[model samples]
Target: MYKILIVEDQEKIRNELGELLRRYGYEVVIIEEFENVLEDIKKAEAHLILLDINLPVYDGYYICKEIRQTLDTPIIIVTSRDSDMDELMSMNLGADDFVTKPYNTQILLARISVLLKRAYAGYQEVVQFNNFKINFSKGILINDGQEVELTKNEMKILACLTKDKGCIVSREDLVSYLWDSEWFVDDNTLTVNINRLRKKFESIGVENVIQTKRGQGYFIE
Candidate 1:
């Protein structure tokens, strides 16, 4: 099933949308913490998002911009604002579609279904080399049918390497991917994350899953 996230602060709207989407066989998550919208989005791992304009801490535009930096998931602005500028701004901020409030339930569901099918109809979830099962939507990793605890950095590194298995990822690229912004992170931090990932692999009986090239980079073989 495809996962969907609804980022509206109003309890009634959030619950109604979630229930409607769930009835259509979609795994839906409603955003509870408005202050940490981006973090909640990452945790939901949703294929598509229905975001509202007015929020408590930050507006939907800010969240959309932040999400675009790392993820390519579809975002549909579902707001009460029907102004042309509002629609244009959302599109400019990487929103895939826009729907104003008081929308017809059927039409909203149709838009959602079309976007979900277009984005994920044939896409398969990625599987790591060492029998580590990662549910990108839930941000959970499973090893031997049990959940494996991983730091956020570890998950990001593993996702990057496993997504490009057998390809050497340069240190610069790895650092950029992990940091996501122009923040300076020590080289030793990357090394630590890699070591932690190696231990996880070792725990699952997979030796040398991630190979290093002295001055080049690392790759999952």
Candidate 2:
């Protein structure tokens, strides 16, 4: 099931939407802590987000901007502000769709279903490996039927290796993929992350999937 994150402060509306989406077989998570909306979103690994414009600590626009920095997940602004400018601004800020308050639940459901279908309907059509599933849309890794939470660097490294499975990726290429043009990263930091990732793979019985090529670099078979 796809995961949806609801970032509305009103308990009634949030619960209502959550129940509506859950009925359609989507796993919905309503944000309870408004102070750390971005952190909650990252942890939830939501495929889409239902965001409200008017929030307590910070508005939805700020949250949307922050989310777009690292995540390309679809976002729909579900708010009371129903103006052309609001809709345009939301779209400009990376929101895929906008729905006003007191919306027809059926219409909302239809739009959500269409978006989900368009985005992820054919995602799981093929299984890659015995213990790994790739979410091409969200760039997430699933191991042994559970999502493997990876750090930013870990994901980048894994992505690079997965792209060239069985082919060796040099250390220099891995550093370039992770660091900026000017920034420098310590070699020890990369080793530590690789060790942690190996442990994560071991937990799912994919031990030594990432084989070190010693003098060359690393490869996944």
Candidate 3:
């Protein structure tokens, strides 16, 4: 089943859209925090997204661009802003489709169906971020023209951080991922790996990408 993330802030619209999608046999994840909409979508591992333009912390255009940089998750702008500029901005930011608010249910569903097919059929192999192209399949991080090798653990850590790019990744979650991969290690080991990862980033002429969140976790700055 395809996962559909609803990033709309209006309670009624969000719920209604979710219900509509759910009825069509799509699993829906509703957004509860407008301030962290993009993070929520990433964590959900959603197949497609219905994003709103007028959000609390960041607008849809900003979120769209950020997601496009790292992921190719199909985004359909479901917003009340129907101006030409709004539509143009949505397209310019890499949105797959646009649906104006008070949308006709059928048209919305059709657009989503098309985008989902396109997305699942072909997805980006490299996640682009800050002049770096991270290739997970080959365990390589490329910057400019240089290629930096990453160990299995380092690759996993980088994957986790890049997956949650603009948001914090809790230490607990990172540890859990490692455990799930049958590579159990102490917290100290994770720290050492993180430091090494930072050094690799530095070698690539990048800095401050992996940020420590004090008692929380880590995030890409």
Worst 10 residues of 1 by lDDT: 119-128
Better structure of 2 and 3 per TM-score: 2
The C-alpha lDDT values of all candidates are 0.77, 0.77, 0.77
What's the CA error at residue 85 for candidate 3, in Å? Answer: 1.0
Lowest-scoring 10 consecutive residues by lDDT in candidate 3? 178-187
lDDT by residue (tens digit), candidate 1, 1-221 = 57788899999989988888888888888888777778888767676889998998989899888876656577899999999999999999889899999999999999988886665443235455555676543445677776544444565677778776688998889888867443545667678678877887677556777899989999987
TM-score, candidate 1, is 0.66
- Cα RMSD of all models vs. native, in order, equals 5.6, 5.9, 14.9
Candidate 3 lDDT over 17-68, as tens digits, reads 8899999999899987876676776667577788999888998899998876
Please identify model 3 stretches exceeding 4 Å from their true place. Answer: 122-221
TM-score of every model versus the real structure: 0.66, 0.69, 0.55
Per-structure clash totals for the candidates: 0, 0, 0
Best of the two (1, 3) by TM-score: 1
